[model samples]
Target: MTNAEANSGKKAVIFNVQRYSTEDGPGVRTTVFFKGCPLSCLWCSNPESQQAKPQMMYFSKTCVQCYACVKACPNGANKIKDDGSVWVDRSVCTNCGVCVKVCLADARSMSGKKMTVDEVFDIIQKDSLYYINSGGGVTLGGGECTTEPEFVGELLDRCYDRAIHTCIDTCGYTPWSVLEKILPKVELVLFDIKHMDTEKHKELTGVGNELILENAVKIKQMGTRMIIRLPLIPGYNDDENNIKVMGWFMESWGMDRIDILPYHRLGENKYDALGMNYSLGDLPNLAKDSISRAVKILGSYGLEVHVM
Candidate 1:
């Protein structure tokens, strides 16, 4: 039986399958972003990915005030307030996606969809020529792919069988047993490290970094190719103390490559559409000088620094 045939019963709630992406991994890649997460980071760009189930997102600016959604919603979830703003009643909303269908401006959408391994695999295989010529393949990312270990493992196993390079973009906040099963098939791991300090880590991201830090050590020992991705947030992890500690940790773990992702406000609008509050209100992007300083500090530990 094929990999998909063996895992036919398994399905994962995925938010997006971004195609022709070069930044996610080596060469060109198709990033499969799954829904569900353990960590609620203060600066998460993809707020829609945090939830396990499907969510209705409304882009207020693009809405044409067609009122089609108001008439279509059986639960009266979509309403227009007296101020001419769209209001979504989460308490009454079943997330049945009725309102999303009637959105004339293409402003409303459901964030997640359930897909079987075969369904997603068909899409991945369609880009085989791109993966072959460009030395890239598939990237399984989150909310946290490990949250749905069985489905992700089976999918990655399929990639391994086909000799297509596979990578995982993860936060590393998962049980070792999960990675133990999936890492063997993954050619590269884009491990995200938010903060080195455990207390500060918890304060910023909802969970402590003990497990994440430990997993980094284990992943290195497993002889799997991995890169440390640090999303450098201004006035947060860019402090000298944090940078120094991260460098020390990198050296201790024998991890040399580090990708510096300067913070941006790209996802701010998503929070509004999702009717969720963004914790970091109006935080500006990381300055060029701060990025340079971080690069210098990490480079002090002899890391192969790549600014993304």
Candidate 2:
């Protein structure tokens, strides 16, 4: 069932509720992936979560092109443009969700569902036993958890009241006020740092890094336990200079640990499922030695580094 149906009496937008996650935080956890994000990172792992609304996605590979969706759409909203590329006129479509229901090959799909605070709490509460055993509880990940600050803040407050260990896996791209609202309830913050260079960061992620960096420092200052996660993308931010800059920043912030997420092509397939281009497909995964080099650089600054 859609999140909306599941939370008919409440209000929030959740795209996916993933359980038994070990990598997100301190222990085994449940990750609630909120539905919207502000940045357009080229290597984003979850492109479907980018848009805030419930929208259709087409997997061309799985599509038989039988025109099932074309036939089912009542508003003539689905059509093949003059260039022979299938397109959905989002403005005309009511999101009645007719096309997705009739797709036999599972090519057409929808993302995002409206949910309520209580409905979300129910899901997180189910895993309370697991949390108690593993020292883990709930982690709010996104599309940028801060995108819907009020919902996140309320949910976080509830989790905190329940004594649940909460971690916010964020891009640090949100306003400080929003961070301030949620920081008190968060036990740990998994903040992502993509690149040190503002221009390079903008080119890669389609947003400036100034606010993100500022927010990171603010989060640290707030005394919330923080871990910086660096996605070591090859030819993007894997150079010695970038690593050194990152090390210097971590050292200055008095932050001890950082996660070196060696870049992988694992999410390339997801892009196809969403009918989006995988620009980094041709780029090979970051080499083990390259990751080691990065780790050593950070270690030189007396910072603990985990290569994940």
Candidate 3:
């Protein structure tokens, strides 16, 4: 079933509604982060978003030893250890939010929430003055905004009706039809290019670049403004050869601009909270020199490059 069909109730699963964002798009904007993603990027910052369902997150430091969660859990997922600290068995936990509901110390929480299109717009509308003043509106990001194409489409349509500028921050790993449905309402598309080499792209992001590349061309042909974003991961896609290949793609495809995002450990603690192992443990952030080198290459291709 399509994302919208699965959510026929007209509600989409989202994790966050961040406001006053300057990086996502043109002006002061609100970014709605959806849950679920098809790719398993090794350096995923938002590890909690990879799952399409609501997930429980634990903060051990906040536990007050009230044992409320242990008493509230129906699945016996919460256990009191000999040290008086509770351990959560994620496998047994159904993510029913029972523990979160009973947690007095706010230690346990759920990541995703279901909200209707109008409900999301209500929050966006509060920032309407900011959007109009800054030329920024709302940006639908992921887990892959296209995963909920119908919901996002409806949200974008409403924004357009209100004259709010729209943007979608995507990985371009979705079906073209899904994108086609939303593009009419989207003013800008923040498309990601993980790797130009097909096999390398698959190895890093768990998918080939053929479909993504094809969609990039299709998006351009659809008359949508697009920006190519590259997540600069050290010792991965930041190599000279890979950067050269990426530059060539921009030049050949006539992409107007590119955004190079330096990889960082900003999301490392998130994996711990989600009870997942971080693939790139303690990896250093991409150096300024490397970013400059990449900028030079893309500049040689006559493409506008911005480090985000």
Query: Which pairs clash (backbone N, Cα, C closer than 3 Å) in model 1?
Result: none
Which stretches of model 1 miss by more than 4 angstroms? 1-5
TM-score of each: 0.97, 0.90, 0.94
What value of lDDT does candidate 3 attain over all alpha carbons? 0.89
lDDT of 1 at 193: 97
Error of 3 at 127 (Å): 1.1
Candidate 1: global Cα-lDDT? Answer: 0.91
Highest TM-score among the candidates is held by which one? 1
Per-residue lDDT of 1-308 in model 2, one digit per residue for the tens? 33322333436678888999999998889899988888888888888778787767766667777788898999998888675556667668876779999999897777778887777888998989899999998999988888887777778767877788999999989888788988888899999999999999999999889999898888888899999999988999999999999999989988889998888776677777555778887888778889989989999999999988
Q: What do the candidate models score in CA lDDT, each in turn?
A: 0.91, 0.85, 0.89
lDDT (10s digit) by residue, model 3, range 166-255: 999999999887888889888999999999998999999899999999999999888899999999999989999999888888788788
Task: Compute the lDDT of residue 284 as modeled in candidate 3.
Answer: 82
Write the residue-wise lDDT of candidate 1 on 201-298 in tens digits.
99999999999999999999999999999999999899988998999899988998999998987899999998889888968868899999999999
Ranking by TM-score: 1, 3, 2
Every candidate's CA RMSD: 1.2, 4.1, 3.3
Candidate 2 lDDT: 0.85
